[model samples]
Target: MSAVPEPAAVKTAVITGADSGIGRAAAVRLAEAGMDVGITWHTDEAGAERTAREVRERGRLAAVARMDLTRLPEAADTVDALADELGDRVDVLVNNAGTGSAVPFLDLGLDDVRRVLDVNLVGPFLCAQRAARRMIARGEGGRIVNVTSVHEHQPRVGAAPYCAAKGGLGLLTQAMALELAEHGITVNAVAPGEIATPMTGQEDTDVRTVSRPGVPLGRPGDAREAAAVIAFLAGPDASYVTGASWSVDGGMMLMGPMAGSHLTGDDWRRP
Candidate 1:
């Protein structure tokens, strides 16, 4: 009998804001699963290189680029550039770059709100469009995972812009999923709650040491925990799953009603 040839391996994945935290974790996870990764950072080239080193240590190819999500259509060029460096195809795109504003709605400046939306919403939109176009052109299925927050489904008191941008992204994920299904593309969002990442000022701290009473999990989530869920969505098992916002929040979304009832005064509204 003749020997059978194995299929060729897929090309690469482009992950934005992958210098640290959940983005870095996801990059490492996917690389461990035998995928080459392209990492992008805003101001942390050193951190990005560190992540690339980790990916390389896993025996996968790694590429790095600078991507400022606020730069819009121009920033999205990084995706193409990365694809060019990684065999001219991107099999997965993770839009994990985002910024948040802690100011109250009334206290927020227009520029601040715009900046948040530019990073969290507009940036993902542009990148997804660009990646999807490439995926469709290549006639191969692709995956897109947007790293939203718990606020994507619920509102936060002091994070007006962040909440709004995440909420919009939740819908955008569904929209992309619907429109891209015919092209074998899957679009989804991962909503993480209270992850122990630098964004929460918890970098290098053990998540088990943090107490989050409101979260049913009793402690903040680990960045790797969130990354695992993202990895599942990007892998072959998620071929049938699309247009879903997977909550990697440790059941925190279930505490909304109980938390609201416990709020006894206006102090909670003051930021």
Candidate 2:
């Protein structure tokens, strides 16, 4: 058998919220994997520029754009601008920008709930639509990966809006996959557990507890680890994989309410 050569084509990917956390990791990894990257940051230009620098070090073209996802009117235009700047329509789209609310569900104002939904759900819908249309016009297969979270399936006490939005995103991924498959486009999602990142907080007690005896892996997931999954789904290897919600949660989802109930039992070690 002959070894396959590295891909020579110069692919382009547009990643939202590329300034930090999983988004930052993904941008760098994709650039290293030989893809020109278009990145968007909501506020931190410095961080975005740093990510671009890293991409350049990987010897790939990098374009940075500022996007406030709340301004839903600008979503498609934002994608078009990146496609123009990158000199190719997006071959991959990673919808990783998301915000969460810690307030109790009852105390949450309508505006706050709406804000979360707009960024997490509506923003990705607009961006994916724009990117898919361009890719379909080109008559080439493309990939769209939504960065969901474990909360997409499991409910959290104070994260009603975040959970709801991600849950909606899961279904949206399926719907988009069905609709876009005919156009040679694939839509999928990566649902990560408590990953160590700025978004998760370096000192977050939640992440620490997440890796306790409760979790099967007994540790919180790393941002780079999550990025690896996104990279695979974005690359050619995932051609047959679409409309799938791949959970990167260290088996957290498998731990039901009875996971720890047997911890006190002497027979708990039998497994």
Candidate 3:
């Protein structure tokens, strides 16, 4: 019998803010799918290490790096550093690191607004640019997934900065997809609503435990649920998917009109 040729090595995925929440879930899921993972954390070194451990447990190489999105260029450099650690190539980049603000628009500070934009919008732009450059240079197609929010499409009472940043990111995803398509790189966004994660102050809680009347599903979404969408966008199945925003929000967007009709007072508009 003729000898069979060995398959090529698995690709690598770099996920920002992988210390926890959707980022961590995506990292683990990608690792499970046989891709080496590079995880980045801002202030949660321990959490990043835990995620890396989970990735390694799945029998994939895992690398960890500290990335502060405020330092956009430096933060982008971490992707290159991680690629260096993971065989000099990056096949997927997940811009999941972000910050949120809840102050009323009138009370929001200028500095705080800038911080949110820097982290949520500019940071991801730089990171994606860096990854795209590498992918284009490598002459291989790649994936880029941005984690936006339901607020990207709808307004939130006290989340002016967050909403603005996410909305901008949503459009940026489409623009990048248009520009990067020629290079065979797909750019997409995942908009998650009421996900059970530390960012929502729901750590260690089952999504089923939360009650969200606005969501048709009647509960929050699990981090893994959002991660599954990201994993799909980053995998070969999404080869034809680009310039799109996937709502992993359990039909939350559908309740907008209903929520507006049920609003009986002006209190929601108050600071």
Best by lDDT: 3
Write the residue-wise lDDT of candidate 1 on 76-158 in tens digits: 99999998899899999999998897787788899899999999999999999989898877877789999999899998788
Q: In model 2, how large is the Cα lDDT of residue 260?
A: 27
Between candidates 2 and 3, name the one with more favorable lDDT.
Answer: 3
TM of each candidate vs. truth: 0.91, 0.88, 0.91
Name the better of 1 and 2 by TM-score: 1
Candidate 2 to truth, TM:
0.88
Candidate 3: tens digits of C-alpha lDDT, residues 127-228? 999898988887777899999998889988888899999999999999999888877888999999888899988977877776666566777889999999
Looking at candidate 2, the ten consecutive residues that score lowest on lDDT are 1-10
Which pairs clash in model 2?
A: none
Query: Poorest 10 consecutive residues of model 3 by lDDT?
Result: 1-10
* Cα distance off (Å), candidate 1, residue 169: 0.5
The list of candidate 3 runs beyond 4 A from truth reads 1-10, 257-271
In angstroms, give how far residue 67 of model 2 lies from its true place: 0.8
